[model samples]
Target: MFRRFVAIVAFVALAAALTLVAWPQLLGLQRAPVLALAVSFRGAAAAAALAVAVVLTAVGLVLHRLRRGLGVLALLLVAFAAAEAGVLVVRGVGAPDVPVAQADDVTVLSWNTLGDSVPAQVVARAAAENRATVVALPETTEGRARQVADLLARQGSTYTVFSRSQQAGIPARSTSVLVSTALGRYREVTADGDTVGVPSVVLDPAGGQNAPRIVAVHTTAPYDLDPATWRSDLRWVAARCSERNVLIAGDFNATIDHLDGLGPAPGRLRTCRDAALATGNAAVGTWPTSMPALIGTPIDHVLATPNWRFTGFRVLSDDDAAGSDHRPVLARLRPAG
Candidate 1:
């Protein structure tokens, strides 16, 4: 009787743990260590669940006495897997076709060049091809940005560059932004402070009247094993997004899941909404070109204040061999009025 009681307790504990793993937010443990990592890669988590289910089924076939218990555990895993898949489906999976830019439409492209791994010419061509007026590059130096601007100018596309760096030597500490001359001149204004560790660029139009505030973001990656710094960077970015009429782009080092409670509003960090999510492309990942979009994590993004509406968003994967592990994300927006 004591053995049976212990078994029941163990079963209950296992089910509870799995349930929390599948949905960490249930207990506000989404940001906890193992749970945070698990949610970051839902596809992998789901696959793991199914794999364990298969093993459980094999064990059940050989061990009759424990067969029922194992079978129950296997079913639980399968259910968790299905639930994760259902979430992905609900968030979205397919990429939408990019819309042609209108005269007043603003085309923003965000790409982490992996510390200038991609050539300036390639970056220029990408912007021109997409008719991007604003480009945010994380882990890119001012020198590389100038090269891109010069290349664009030689090709009849004029751009003004703004850049910031936490320190010299480390390319990851730098970030660059390019705003087309067509949109008027913009000046770098993040002199006082920046993200917790990674450098981020803040820009304001020359007149600073009736223009959108722009931020080129590069938050510390969680893999640095510095959760505090990572979370602080996210919070700082969120504060910037609170104001109206803002445009933000770059490597956030976080997924929408990780942004919960960090935002001022539900589904928004401050008032900024993720363009990919608004356009139904949130499920498509943007990092680790080695993995399929469905399996990898979406750490890159473009977000805008409520004043702007997202017409289209997509993660560009054709340049898989482009030297950078990240795939470029493009978001097209127009004033909401």
Candidate 2:
């Protein structure tokens, strides 16, 4: 009986570990009818880890020789699992994305123009009202993006970079960066990625020795898109921003708990749930502001490096809801000095 119980415990532990390894992949299946499977990835990973720890603990209590080994392994597994679960839970529960500032710092804002209709004017207004030092706009058309730049110029913005479409007039369905004279004073360099819509910038305030790099990306959504493709694109974005103070902001088109291969990138990237909700509207819903119910998921997002913190964050939807479906988002950031 004791031997049988030990075997059962080992089987359960092994099963849990296996589930953790494949849970993220299973959720990526965009076409999969099991919607619950996709949304439950984080919870499932946490459960599996706990189950493994419990089973190992039980087995360790019964086995005299393997007690030390099992206890050590179980403790390690539980610690790692708890840490992972804690981060996910904090993100899922919706924490503030705004920075808690001290005194001297620069402010940045990120928003999706919802295809550049009236939303453009709204974003322009919001930027002007807030006096954002740097502005990031995603899903902007060539014409609409120019309009945003022009609007910023009216409010004292001098430098701007818009991604050009394959055709001269058309604009890539990506994102662009606009900087005020204050930000431009720091040497600015922008690089447009091929596979993904990413423009990275390095800012050296006053041409100082220590400068920070910011990579802005507009990630592809999984809706009817392959997770593998999204993963490849995300990998490219990650590679470019690796080991730097990267700030990924734009319409991700994928929720934090988005379904895997079933949707877009399976294991590569995730929506920052806390940031999304904090900067999104309760009534406005997700992107394509027009069809809130059909695509009811918070897709737009802004993720900053650990060093860069937010002071204020909000989703500008009430007045901005003119022609487009998405609401513009604003965030005040405080980069560590």
Candidate 3:
């Protein structure tokens, strides 16, 4: 009787896991509160499924004569797990590496500074090391932005800082953008009154005729508190991306999966992860610095329009020790002919 119960429990667990792995959106499970937890840890779920399959297969082989029916069920579970494993592998594969950027390539760095935890000097050093032409900091305050700008100036960088206003009594988070003087003049662009906290700025290159826009984004996290606002914030950013000559970067709070219907069209905004995968580094994640990058969700990104070609992409794992919960994403891009 006890052995029968064990078999039943294993079968139930495997079946539920398989359903989630196979088709989350088919049953409206993607938005379900209970299933949303599974979506966030899809990588870990795949690993767990593989482990269960191996254990169950071993048990089935050992007791084939005593429990022929159990052995068959175990085999079915193994097949389902294998299918999920294939999906995970394909999703995790890195893109092929493009050639390293030329001397004139523009490098942009995006990070969420977690309010005041990250020191201005650390941010400055990282920007200097990468020689970033544009830096986007989400969840940064006005005072912190100034400190970062001052630190960069000390390092011989002439970066002008633009940030959303921080009301005296309000506890709202702000996004900040730092444009290097070498990139020419730039000004802030408003994205309607509702989305004031998300910073958008346009840069007029010193010698180039066209002006490109940069948006530092931080959308609300989709949790029990208010998932609607989270979805709305993402749509707003997507609308901005619909325009030409724009580069959107920072903590989007949504993964590539969550961005499905939010953008102008499918495949409209080019994600840096494509370059990272091509370069054989798709395993690198950029959130919750405490966890290994391979398993953490990559909520931070540097996405660009079709007008720019990505030459290199990297998730700066070394910055995990820099006090912020998110590691920085840096991408090198050149204008597409």
The TM-score leader among the candidates is: 1
- Where does candidate 3 have its weakest 10-residue lDDT segment? 266-275
Candidate 3 structure quality by residue, lDDT tens digits, 29-115: 553454554555545555676677677667767886745665656566667656655654655644434345576678888888887
Cα error, candidate 3, residue 306 (Å): 0.5
lDDT of 2 by residue, 206-311 (tens): 5553334544556554433344545455455545445445555555555554423322232223321224433333222345555432223455555555456555
The C-alpha RMSD in Å for every predicted model, in order, reads: 1.8, 10.9, 4.5
Local accuracy by lDDT, each model: 0.86, 0.52, 0.68
Report the C-alpha lDDT of model 1 over 35-153, residue by residue, as the tens digit: 66668777767888999999999999999988998998898899889988887777778667888999889999999999899999889989999999999999999999999999999
- Of 1 and 3, the candidate ahead on TM-score is 1
Candidate numbers, best TM-score first, in rank order: 1, 3, 2
**Could you tell me the lDDT of residue 154 within candidate 2?**
77
Show model 3 residue runs off by greater than 4 Å: 1-17, 21-37, 54-85, 92-103, 165-172, 191-209, 263-283
Residue 101 C-alpha lDDT in model 1: 93
Clashes of 1: 0
